[model samples]
Target: MAQPTVTDIRAYVLRGGGADYHDQQGTHWIDDHIATPMSRYPEYRESRRSFGLNVLGTLVVVVEASDGSTGFAVTTGGEPAAWIVERHLSRFVLGAPVTALERIWDQMYSATLFYGRKGLVLNAISGVDLALWDLLGAVRQEPVHEMIGGAVRDEQRFYATGARPDLAVRMGFLGGKLPLHHGPAEGAEGLAANLALLADMRAAAGPDAWLAYDCWMSLDTDYALRLARGAAEHGLRWIEEPLPPDDYWGYQKLRKALPPGTLLTTGEHEATRWGFRMLAEMGCADILQPDVGWCGGLSELLRITAIADAHGLLVVPHGSSVYSYHFAVTRHNSPFSEFLMMAPAADEVVPMFHPQLLDEPVPTDGRLSVSTLDKPGFGVRLDPGLPLHRPYPR
Candidate 1:
């Protein structure tokens, strides 16, 4: 059979919630009092959105093939991402073969080197790359996990990231990761509050629940060490993203300084294989958490996983919903996945990227059977009637 070639690529931007999971309204726990780099300024400390965390909405990319199959994906990067896709990246994708993911990715990356290496540009590249994978899966009539390799296990398990680890435990997750509510700038009182919350959560979750804290790049080396020591007494499993993603030296220092048995993890904001290579080779983290949507998509994630596997590190990708789920199932190094609790009070289960995707699967009892993803591509569809705006016209 002749291979299908890419005929067109389209990019659209959506406001509110979608792939931009942070773009939520009215008291979502994710934005409330979570420790962030901006926490140093008391004004932005109360809410991440206060510092424009949700300003960049969702970027939706659609790739159409000559065989009449279209595959789409959503990521964080609103109008600017759409503009990059249509004005620049689309040239690399427009005439490529459907299976030329690597070449297309390389072209996009190499061409944008002067302006793109991480952050928004990589987000745009990741969206395009993911849409290509979805397109390939549609053409092959296989799920993305199957495209990569078959699942190592029958089902995928999850640990929830939320305000209520106690509720998540009842919901059947292996454990719960709580957001670190205070940063270094908050001082001793804030540190005490953070430890108190962890103790309370541990009390509610009881012993045996794997409790962890996601600091979200908001702490200094000294504060991270102090928090790890304080949290260790409460049975903290790991401290995630304690410092900014680029602080490999700090990571190396903090990882060694952490209380024995408490793991230091980072990299939800890191991108590409080269970046992950630095994490692994430098012993910067015990686990790697790359968000497939923002970390160069599946094409780059495969390489990232290989680097992790070689270094004997676990590749627990940061939550990007199905994009993470599909990739997680196929990797032996990935024993479980992270699910972000979208429920406002963290009391119920809801789709992580609500209202944007139709048929997006949620874990039943904190587990998703591989069968839930048996449908072609990522096995999720976007609502055709969604109010998506095409910000950049080709």
Candidate 2:
């Protein structure tokens, strides 16, 4: 029996240019239109715009005894997810052992503890953890799914919830998740429109498939209540980020208030399983949406899912989505995973380690196969086939 010792961890900083900076700017402008006054708080962005460098990261894990045998993983911080990784993270990663992924994750987390306890730091660790997993698989000669455990289902069923409802229906993806068309910042009208849209999507998706929608915290107590009530008949499975991520009580209320059948879930931006534990203790959500990178990578995701499992909740690891399919398949309790309706221009801009194969207008079956690693470690390769350019000065 041989166990491989981790050799070194390298942070490959990937960057690229050309994006729908204008379109993203337009979307943020809409948010700015309504949420501007709320920005009296300092947490708002520069000039209230959301367009920036879309850095995609992957952790290249190397083993002591293996050559030409290391592996990689995805850490997608779409838009600005890269700057946070390279500017602050790469230093912490160099010289670390690949096998100490979870431990190294803690060290990196501790380093970033003073400032970014949740968002950027954990997201970076996610990339590292995944890379380690890929490396572990390659070094040990196994698939990531094999190392994590085994497949829960022969094939994972996914929902392209990132799609607009009607468009998703047209694509034949019965299960679809909708984004926040409006938010609490917009007041009652926003709430009203969301509820109506939920109804329309449910009618379109019909009874058998799952139809989920994101609140993206556009809802306050009253708004969530209103939409939750109206959304009952439409057969909506779950509503995501219905309120602010910190609003645990709001989720508790929504969980109880929204008819008993409606499932509540979140955790896309939440950083660690510690946050998830709180949500679990409070009965905050019916499901947990720990993003791999944000939630401290697969290490914490497994722990968070365990907590969610104890709480009788389902775990749905949210985006940095490139890794979701494989992670979902690996987890025994992962019920579903999500994907963007259409691959982002960033995928073309920044050469992500893992290149997506399905470029259909939409996923016909709502499922995509994660690259099956025959070697050790997670085998994500950022072989970007797009016209690469310098997205930033550095």
Give per-residue CA lDDT, model 2, range 1-394, as digits (tens).
Answer: 4455554444433332211111232233223322222323344423334322233333222223235456555454443444554556555555554466666677777887887777655666676666667676666677666777766676555566453555555555557776656555555786677778777766666667677777665567786676777777787777778677888887787788877777888887676878989899998887788877557877778788788878788887764444555567776678666655433321111212223312211223554444333333444444456323323223
Indicate which candidate wins on lDDT.
1
Candidate 2 positional error at 229, Å: 1.2
Lowest summed lDDT over 10 consecutive residues: which window, candidate 2? 345-354
lDDT of each: 0.93, 0.58
The top-ranked prediction according to TM-score is: 1
> Candidate 1 on 1-394: residue-level lDDT in tens?
6789999999999988778888888988898899999999999999999999999999999999999999999999999999999999999998788999989999999999999999999999999999999999999999999999888899999999999999999999998999999988889999999999999999999899999999999989999999999889999999999998999999998998889899988889999999999999999999999999999999999999999999999999999999989999988899999999988888998999888999999999999999999999999999988998998889
Query: How many clashes would you count in candidate 1?
Result: 0
Error of 2 at 306 (Å): 1.2
